[model samples]
Target: MKQSALSYFQYPEMVLVPLILFFVFFMLLLFFITRPKNRELFKKMEKMPLEEEETNNESIE
Candidate 1:
């Protein structure tokens, strides 16, 4: 008799750890990226490509 792949995860704890870790990692990422303190930083990053030419022109003048 052959055991299906699901049989490997017969023990709940075996699957619980990875699920918990993934959830924690996702939440932390969401929190960090959306935090108020980092808002300005993200805004600047969003405009980087658009501002490149303006910055270059100022430097040349």
Candidate 2:
């Protein structure tokens, strides 16, 4: 049997990097399109613990 550079990508594992990158790029584009609300939602999600703490503190007061 013989192999060439083109045959390298025929190997499933070897093709994964580009496939993964493609989807990652797609997701980034989707994220950018939803920019402002995405950032606000991300910030809200990130502050969940702080909001939870505030609720706990208020209940204790």
Off by over 4 Å in 1: 1-12, 54-61
Candidate 2, after superposition: displacement of residue 4 in Å?
13
Error of 2 at 6 (Å): 12
Each candidate structure's TM-score, on Cα atoms with residue i matched to residue i, is 0.55, 0.38
Writing each residue's lDDT as its tens digit, candidate 2 over 3-30 gives: 5666755667868989999999999999
lDDT tens digits, residue span 22-45, model 1: 999999999999899999999899
Error of 2 at 19 (Å): 0.7
Name the 10 consecutive residues with the lowest summed lDDT in model 2. Answer: 52-61
Every model: Cα RMSD to truth? 7.6, 7.4
Angstrom error at residue 54, model 2: 60
